[model samples]
Target chain A: MSHPNRLNINVENLAIGYKDRVICQNIDLKLASGELCAIVGVNGVGKSTLVRTLGNLQPKMNGEIQIAGENLGAFNMDQLAKILSVVLTEQPASKNLRVQELIALGRQPYTNWIGTLTQEDKRYIQTNLKAFLLEDLKQRKCHELSDGQLQRVLIARAAAQDTPVVLLDEPTTHLDLYHKVQILKMLQQLAHQSKKTIVFTTHEIDLAIQLCDKILILDGKTNPFGTPSDLIKQKHFEQLFPSDMVQFDSSSGSFKVKK
Target chain B: MGSQRSYSFVFAIIVLALLLAFLLNVSSGSVNIPFTAVLSGMFGGHMEVESWNYILWNYRMPKAFSSILVGGGLSLSGLLMQTLFRNPLAGPFVLGISSGASLGAALLLMGTSMITGFTVMPFLNDVSLVIAASLGSFLVLLVVLLVANRIKDTMALLIIGLMFGSITSAIVSVLAYFTTAENLQRFVFWSFGSVGNLSSRQVALMGAIVGLGVLLSIVSIKRLNAFLLGENYAQSLGISLKRSRLTIIIATGILAGGVTAFAGPIAFVGLAVPHLTRQIFDTMEHRILIPAVFLYGAILMLLCDVIAQLPNSANILPINAITSLVGAPVVIWLLVRKRKMLF
Candidate 1:
């Protein structure tokens, strides 16, 4: 859409945590526009926390996180909202909303005080509804949708916001394997076609390696960041977990269960 | 998601229901005032019976207006709280506004006599009672707001409000134990919660307060909708949590507190009206819920008032009892039929 390689996010030695306790540090990332990236790690390795910090949803404990050369903390919430949209995993349940209505909420940043959707705003919602294949379920209440459908509604809502960047926490946690690939592929399409910088935290390391343009592995130590093949070449995934339980297969770019 | 019918159509139905309920409420009182008399008396036409005209203007009109303001304000605040807390069970009184009013009324009716050992309070009247209740609710709301500022968690604030309720209720109980039987009986009667007994001036004041509260809520539609998804997402979507949350809490306080001040803690209507409105509208959008609840609450209050009046009889039931009796069953029936609560 815009110049594809323009850097959208830059994080250097970023430390993220709640209050004084730092959860993840020495985290480094530089995501250009039109990139789909994943942060994959062991449980409690602060994958979600780092994503939250990057989204500016919470305060960072240390280091610098900049979006397009501006400090993450420099922008007020309104400005930040225009720049980034989030689909949090722990997002409180709002099953009462209809699919169309939830998607329409993505246009809130540009709407009037009463949140009246403009023609352009309505256009964005329609585009997202179609793009995400949610047109058929647009009239259905979100409670009626399966987990895969609901995640689509939430991501479409973020895309409808038309922000430059989107951060999602575990977008495919509850979906089946096929749905997981479907969502990842849609996200890949969104990044390449719409030129939005997309980042998500996920436990799907295999999918992340296969589909994501880049992957950040938080091993509770190095927290390596690079191209998936580069990280694989660097042996970053080998030490990701207890080798006694699961072994990292570098050639195949996936982890295998130990027998 | 929107209702299949146009909002205009739904609004027309709501307006018709409101008018019918208002007329039914006005006509069926202790005295059997005919519908024709109500219409003539309200309009430019002359009433054949002079006393009927006086009753219409002086009593029924003021009482009916009180019902609308009290009902509408309380229900609107209930919707606000439900959205703010993101909890289905949350309502206007969850913040201790009503308990504060009860404490204020109790202190005036019985605590004064208990402390001074004087059997009479010469300055006591309906106006003073209202002032006392207003002061009490205002004080508790102030404390709650201050605490809310310091605490980031909403459930914690709810617990604090409940603690305030427990504290005020305990004080009221102590006053009840110490006061004489006459003072206690007066306190009990005041606690019954009437939409009558308010003078024209008092009703006007209540109307102004409810109007201001409604206007504040109307402008807050964006924040209300954001809050439906809970605070984190709301914050992400450009809502400054501290500022938005405070304004909503203050609006709810003015509404629930002002209504409780005038009407003495009317029950079940606040807790049930939003849920009922959702059943009909089948949407979470505040643009619709605010007006829908306002209309439904007014109509329900008017109907409950008519039943409480116990037409053509000297005896009257407490409005608090009538609201609970009518509201509780409908909610039960709705839940039973759906086999699920509207989340």
Candidate 2:
């Protein structure tokens, strides 16, 4: 498949970690528009730190990140908000907010000082509501939503934000297999239809491999980014985890436990 | 839309209750001013009795206005604190602002006697005590703001505030031990919290400060609503977390510090009125909650002040005692009835 030349994000020699500690270093990647990329790693391999660094939620320890040729550090919060949107794993403080109201918050960058939604804002929200099949849940409070439903609403919120890039931290977490696949499929469709760059971190390597156009494998030794076929050919997943309990089956593109 | 209609209905009822409580508080004081006299006095009409005029204007009017201001200020502060911390149990005093004010007042009232060799100073009136209290609260607020900028976690900020409060309390205790019986008695009385002791000028000052706080809160309604999604999400939405946090802390300081300076750290109204408004209005939007809490707080404080007056008796109870006595039970009833996590 031929990828578009329009780059949404570019990271060069990026170092991300917490406080004085560095988790990953010398990371370089380029993500283009209309791509669905998944960052797959074992638990605590700095997937979140990398995602947050790219989103500018956490300060990068070193290196430069650029969105549309503008340095990430050069964009103010408001400017960055128009370029990128993020969906976090933590629940909102008040689940008492209505679904539509919560989703409308995506228009914060576009709204006036009081955050009144305009006609264009309403259109964006309506499109997401239809796309995510959230019309029935529009009037319901967020606390009343199931985990899968809430995750979908959050994703819809990010879509309504109308940014060029959307980053999600474990979008399929806390979902059963059916719902997980359903959300992944929806994300895949969103990326393809909107021509937006969609990046998410997940532990579901097998599922991500099936749906994502490109995968970034971080195994503390080799950090490679490529199409699924290329990463599999490079044997990136085989070294993802310790070989004692679970082994990566390259042929099946999955991990199997040793008996 | 249904919730909006219910919010309006509840708002109207609360407004009505507030007016009724205001009239009741203005008329039913120890001197028993007639309802007509109170109404006429309020509107600059001729009064039936001149003494009733004095009582209504010089005494009851200031007290009633102070009650409204204190109530609205404290409740709004509490609402801001709860939102900022994302904790339901947070109140205006959760930052130990009131404790700091108490320490300031304790130092003035107790420490002065130790240094000047006099238990009573003729010049040290309510004004000096208010100044001392304001100084103390503002000092603590400055410290908390400084710490808040460095600490990103709300829970950590809260614990720091509590530590500040404990430190001030320790100093106040040390002061109390060395204070004379007469000076200590004066300090104790100031700590009991009274909305009725303010002169008209002090009431005006309180109104100015609290009005500024309320205005700041109104300006921050959008940022506060964004905060409902927690800090990281809010930041992603273009909210400057540091700026919003600073605005909220300063607003809370003005409201809580101003009220504590004058009303002697009246409790429960700040802590309980926001929860009450949330329960009654059934929405967490700050746009709705800000005005609702303001109105409901004024009503509750007026009602508490009326109850504290003891109805036709000269003896008045401490306003703080009545707030807890009345406010705690209502909150308990709400918890029992709702049977869900309010926060």
Candidate 3:
């Protein structure tokens, strides 16, 4: 396992935007190694877009991102892939691909042009497969799995990617209450054991406040960055949701609609 | 059977089928010849008639081998197109390669007749048509590739390809209208697609083109698999999408154009065989799928040739007609079963 003191990610004055429209701006943040961060916001906010930009999946509008003191663009694809991995929200309909095959794709950066898995690659895959409890479903197609199981499969894939930083878009979107907690716990466990920076976005803010070490809340007007306790202490959780329909009870630290 | 044994079993079946098709093709012809005589003649032993020996070696052997090459080539091209476009409906004909070849052949036949008349132009043979067809097919493929880059939608590219096909067909029709009766007869016959029409030289030519295309496809397996997740995903995996697509488009053009140039536009085999191969193998991996399609295509085409040689039937079935008969049903079955595109 890598040490928290060694792994570092820095985002300086980052502005994430789509074509002809700016989503978020002037975002400066740092993720130390072994941090389990949760990005939370109301619907239509730019949480997912921000995560995607920081992961280097999309181009940032105006600023620089660095991983371990090296500029993002300085590293080639394989070098960058070794540092950061992303689990996209879109569920692929590649039903013909088995669970093992799908996970093996995460090791594609390390494989040769023919896409053969090496012994080290096989070891990585095997470790993740057992970690996610996907051993029995190794031969099963992705389409055959439940949504909860599929989400775990995706996480296992990211683990097999063997990067220091993992960015997931809404990892618990399809899971039930039990699986959601399980996945969040698994992510926290991954961060602690592997010393990887695990960041994910979710609508489950109350649960996030308990599980996540840090919190990034994109309010579409003012983006706030800090741990959950820091945000709660700063008293910024109340203004996040819509003012009329939703009200944040400061004492309970949960949102409720006006009667 | 074990998985490894199952793979070998399939390979053996393909080999046995190839040999059977080869032998049956030699025996069943206009004049019946015994299998024993055909074998004996090939082995330098005494055979029944001199004419039979000549027909077996010169005519049937070339035609059968040519069909094998073209069938395997076109189906492999179809498999590549289906993967490239991510649309099951996409094949060689969808990209207007066939139409381009037809227009090229038409121009040579009708244009030559217009200037020199049929009597003086009698010396010009299938060689001119083959060259013209290959050039036209390559040109259309280049145009389609350029357009494909500008357009993001797969269906839009397919529609554009169909429009190209229509445009070339219209040009051939105009040539047909202007040409004299004798040249028109030659042009029409050329369009109907027969395995028997290929001479030894044309067979050699088709063999070279198909061989090159198949070899290129084999080397492209890694790139092609990346493409299965879509172009953006493929590009992220260190593949230059433009370069990979160019290789695929050129390979497809060679297969479709070379076959159309010599054998005419033999339809349906390209469109149907890839999907059938996928269903049988139950794997989308190109390493397995590409070769599976080639064998599946050869067997299907050979079966169609056998059906084309119906007994007591005054008129022999055109190769296209036989392909359509087998192809149309398979396509319809695919449509009903899958509902969406296979890829």
Candidate 4:
């Protein structure tokens, strides 16, 4: 923890979208180790695109990304894999994989050529299996896990990678409230305990406000980034939705529907 | 760890089964050779009947080796395709490699006769057929590899393969339509699929190509496991999509195409063996599955060849018919009993 304040992710003037189209622009973020951040916005505001761009899974329309003080483009896939890991919203292609087998894939970067796990790799897997409360379900097939359990498994895999930065897209889309908080709280603890930078796109704005150390509210314009209290004082959340149907109350930090 | 410990036991059983199947295949031909003579002859000892020794060395043994290559190669490629495309239904020929082989074979068999109303190429032989089919499959695979480079979606690439299959099969049908009866019969028999046609040299070449394919697959083992999580996740794990996809496509071509070149299209062996191996291995790690599926496929093919040879009977059955008859029911029973296919 000597470099606990090290800059983990640096983004400046980033624009993300598919070819011939721009989804969002002028996005800027600066995060350090031991912090959990959330990207929050209304639907179609390009939250997932930004997350994918940061992970280099999707190309950025314009701007620069730096991870651990190195240009994102300078690293090859193998080097990038050692430094970062990504989790998408979609389930893995093969659900028949055992839970431990699915999570152990995160160690591919450090394993031997034929992928025989070393003793160090096995220790990482065992720690994550216990950290995610997945020891009982380790032998179960992924298809047999509940949505919350699977989400935990995916996040646990990213944790198992032991990377300095991890990015996820909508890690709690289909979970109930208790599971949603459970996932977010686990991510928060993972960030603080491992001193790793964690970023995720999510829809639970109130929960994000409660758990995240910092929040980026993508509004397709300025795309502001700040602490929850600073963003709340700036009225960023109030501008998120149309005023006619819903309202963001600053004191309570939750949205209210019109009667 | 428990799974890892039990793999040795499962592999030992499969190796034993393969040996038994090989013995059954080499001894059960229509010549009515004694088991003892077959064994001693195989080991370079003298036999009571010299003809039986000739048959064992020159015919049955070669045919059995051909089956090993055909089955092991096809099943390994099928497993690669299944993992590459993330589709459980994918087979070795899903990329249209076999259809291209069929098209090449059809043109050589019937095109010469239909063009001039006579079998002008009287000097034609098996070499010409093998070359034609190999060239056809590689040509189609090259085009598929190019399309794969352009697009990132795997499902679209699979559809393009299906389109290629349709286009090639349509050309084959047209050739079949205008050809003479003798030419048509040759093409039909080729489609019936036989592993008993290879000489020692062709079997050696097939072995070399299959060895190369298996070696590449072994090098790709880590990436193949990465792909089970899909492409984006694989890339995040440091697997280059373009390189891995191209490598897989070329390796599949080498395998399925080489088999079809010597022994027409052998069905059921490729698509079914991987699934069957999974039913026993119960794991998705490619390191364990690759060799397991190959041996299982080899065993299944040897048994199918034995059944096709029909002990003491002069009538030999088409291997394709026997494979389907034997493989489809076992797969169906496994699926029904398990209540789901273990893709």
DockQ of each candidate's interface versus the true one? 0.55, 0.52, 0.26, 0.63
- Residue pairs in collision within model 2: none
Q: Which sequence of candidate numbers ranks them by DockQ, best first?
A: 4, 1, 2, 3
Runs of candidate 4 exceeding 4 Å displacement? B1-3, B93-96, B108-131, B138-166, B177-185, B334-340
Interface root-mean-square deviation (Å) of every model: 2.2, 2.7, 4.5, 2.0
Please provide, for model 4 over B190-284, each residue's C-alpha lDDT reduced to its tens digit, 9 standing for 90 to 100.
88899897788878888988898899999999899999998889999988998988788777877887778777877767778898898789899
Segments in model 1 whose C-alpha atoms lie over 4 Å from true places: A1-3, B1-5, B93-96, B108-167, B179-186
**Candidate 2 steric clashes:** 0
The Cα RMSD across the true interface for model 3 is: 4.5
- Candidate 2 docks with a DockQ of 0.52
Candidate 1 lDDT, A1-259, residue by residue in tens: 2357888899988888898988778988999999999999889989888888888878888888888668988998888888889998865446778888888877778888998877898888889999999988988887788999999989998998888889999999989999999999999999989999999999999999999998988876678899999998889888888889999998888889999
Model 3, which residues run further than 4 Å from truth? A1-4, A55-57, A220-222, B1-6, B42-46, B94-97, B100-165, B179-186, B311-315, B337-341
Which 10-residue window of candidate 2 chain A scores lowest in summed lDDT?
Answer: A1-10
Clashing pairs in 3: none
lDDT of 3 by residue, A1-259 (tens): 3456564678877788898688787676678889998888887778888877877667888888887768887877667767777777876535556787677777766777667667898889889989999999988777789998888888987888888888899999978899999999999999888999888999999889889988888876557888888899898898886688888776777778888
Q: For candidate 4 chain A, which ten residues in a row score worst on lDDT?
A: A1-10
For model 2, the stretches where C-alpha displacement exceeds 4 angstroms are A1-5, B1-6, B112-135, B138-169, B180-183
- Per-residue CA lDDT of model 4 for A91-125, tens digit only, reads 89899988899889999888888888888888999
Best by TM-score: 4
lDDT tens digits, residue span B1-343, model 3:
0011145577678779877887776677767778799889877888779898888788878878887887898899888878776677777777777888887788787876766655336566666666788778878878876786688577898899899988988877887888888888987998898888577887888888788888889878877876765664454445667789988887887788778888888888898999888777766667777888998888777777867866334356898899988888998998988775455
DockQ of 4: 0.63
**Best-performing candidate as measured by DockQ:** 4
Candidate 2: which docking quality band?
medium
What tens-digit string does per-residue lDDT give for candidate 1 at B40-142? 8889689888899889888999999999988888888888877776666557567777888888888988988877889656888656776787678767767
Each model's C-alpha lDDT?
Answer: 0.84, 0.84, 0.79, 0.87
